[model samples]
Target: MHIVLSGYYGFENVGDEAILLSIITALRKAKPEVEITVLSNNPASTAKTYGVQAVNRWKLKEVSAVLKQADGLISGGGSLLQDQTGMKSIPYYCGIIRIAKFHKKPVFVYAQGMGPIHKSMSQFITKNTLNKVEQITIRDEASKQLLVDIGVNKSMTVVPDPVIGLDASAFRSEWLERQAFESGYISVSVRDWPSEVNFKQKIVESLDLLARSGHNIVFIPMHDEHDEKASFELANMMSEKSLVAPGNLSIEEKITVIGQSDLLIGMRLHSLIFSAIQATPFIAISYDPKIDAFATIANQPNIGHVEKDDWNGEQLFDKAVDMLAERSSIEQALREQVMTLQSDAQNTALMAIDTFK
Candidate 1:
C-alpha cells in the first residue's frame, strides 16, 4: 500500500518533522511493505532530509495522481486545521481530503490537533471534509472536544502525541555526560503564545532566583531562530547575566540539550512532551488549551497560564522549583501515558492501513 501523509512539513519545524517521522515509523512497523510519499513545501529538501518521496503542497495535479495510485491519504498529527495562522490553512488541508475522496481513496485525519478556528467558511469546509473521512484520530481530548463542538462526531478516537512514540533511545545515555551543565540551572523554552501572559516577568523572577542562588540558567528555543533571540532579549531585560542557549543547534541537539536541564519551563507543547517522555522535570506555560489539557492529563496539575499582559516570572520559577521534587513520580506517570499513547497511535495507523489493504 502507498500512503500520502500531509501537514505543515518542510518548514524545519521540529514538532512538524517529529510528527511526520513518528507516523511514518508507526506505519512502517505495522506495514513494512508500504510505499510512502510526503506532501511538503520544499519537496526536494524534504525528500532529501526524510529519505521519502515528496511533492509540492500546491501541486494538486500530482497529488491527485498519487492519491489515485495510493492506498489512502493521512492528514496528520499537528495543528494544521487552525485558521489562526492563515485563512488558507484549513481550506488547503481539507481540499486535500476532498480530492482524496474524489479519487476514491480513503482519507485519515490521523492524530491531529484541532482548532481555535474562527473562520466560518473554514469551519464549513472542515465539517464537510471531516464528515466524509475514513477515520479521525486526535492527539488530545481537548482537540476531540473542539471537533465535537464544531459538529464532528464520535468517529474520532484519542491518540497521544506521536512525538511521544519517537525512538529517542539512541540519545538516552548522552544526558549523563552533560548533566553537570544543568546541576543547578533552570531551563525555559519560549514560543509565540501568551502575549497576554506575563511571561517576561516569570522568566526574570526564575532566573533571578537561580542566579542569586549561584545556579546556571538555560533557555531553549523550540520554534524559530527568533526564539533564542527573544530569549536573549528577555535575558537582557531581566539582568543581562542569564545564560542563553545559542540557536546554532539542530533538532536532535536541542533535545539532547533539553535533557540536561534540572527544571524546564516551556510554552512549546512538544518541548514539554519530550521532557516528560525523557524523565526531565518541566513546568508548562499554558497559552492554549492543548498545553493545559496535556498538563492535566499528565497530572502535573501546576501549569502556569501566562496572561497576555501579566507574564509572571516569579510564579513560573516557583513552580519549576516545586517540580524538581516530583520529577521521579511525574516522569513515571508520564512514561506510562506515553506508552499507552504510542500503542494506541500505532494500532490506529495500522487499522487505517488495513482498510486501505
Candidate 2:
C-alpha cells in the first residue's frame, strides 16, 4: 500500500515532527510493507531529515497523480483543523484532503485535534471538508465534541494524541547524561505570544522563587523557533540564575532534556503533552481553548488565560509555584491516564489505516 501522509511536515517545529514520528511508527507496525510519502513545505529538508519521499505542497498536479496511485491519504495528528493559528490554516489543510478525495482516494483524518475556530469561513471549510472524509479519529473528547458542534456527521472516534505514543526509551542515553543538572531543577517551556498574560514577569518570578528554594532552573522548547524564542525572551527578562537549552537541539534531544526536569511549566500544547507522557509533572499556560481543554481533560493543573486585561505577572507565578508543590502526587495520578492514552493513540493509527481497505 502507498500511503500519503500529510501534516505540518518539513517545518522545524519539534511537536509536529513528534506527532509525525508517532504516526509513522504506528503505521509501520500495522503494515510493514507499505510505501510512505509526505506532503511537505520543504520537500528536500523533509526527505533528507526523515528518510521519507516528499512532494511539495503546491504541486497540485503531482499531488493529484500521487492521490490516484496511493491507497489512502492520511491527514495527520495535529491541531491542523483549527483557524486560531491563522485564517489560512483551514483552507490549506482541508484543500489537500479535498484534492485527494477528488481523485476518489480514501482520506482518513487520524488522531487530529479540532477547532477553536474563530472564523466563519474556516468553520465552514472544515465542516464541509470533514463531511466527505471516510473516517476521523480525534485525539480528545473535547476535539470530538468540537466536530459535533461544527456539524461533521461522519464516523469519528476519540483517541489520544499520537505524541503520547512516543517511546521515551528512544532517548534513554541522552536522558542519563542530562539527569544530574535536573536533580532539583524546575523546567519551563513557553510558546505563543500571550497577549493576555504578563509572561516575562510571571516566569521570572516563578524562576526566582524556585531558585530561592534551592531548585535549579532550566528551559525546554517543544519547538525550536516558537518555544525557544519565547523562552529566550523570558530568560532575558530574568536574572542569570536560569538556563535555557540551545535552539538547535533535535526532537530526541529535547525529549531527553525534558525528561531530566523535576517539574515542568509549559505554554505549548505538546510540551505539556510530552511532560505527561514522560510522567513529568507540569502546569500549562493556556493561550487558547485547545490548551485549556487538553489540560482539563487530562486532569492537569493549569494557569489559563486570566483575560487579556486582568493578567498579572505575580498571580500567574504564584499559581505555577502552587502547582509545582503538588508535583509528586500529581505525577502519580497521571500515570494510569497516560497509559490509556498511549494505547488509544496507537490503536487510532492502526484503525485509521485499516479504513482504507
Task: Indicate which candidate wins on lDDT.
Answer: 2
lDDT of 1 by residue, 263-308 (tens): 6777778777767666677777777777887777666654566665
For each candidate in turn, the TM-score is: 0.91, 0.92
Clash totals, every prediction: 15, 0
Model 2 clash tally? 0
Cα-based lDDT at residue 42, candidate 1: 88
The numbered model that scores best in TM-score is 2
Cα RMSD of all models vs. native, in order, equals 2.5, 2.2
lDDT by candidate, in order shown: 0.76, 0.79
> Which stretch of 10 consecutive residues in model 2 shows the poorest summed lDDT?
173-182
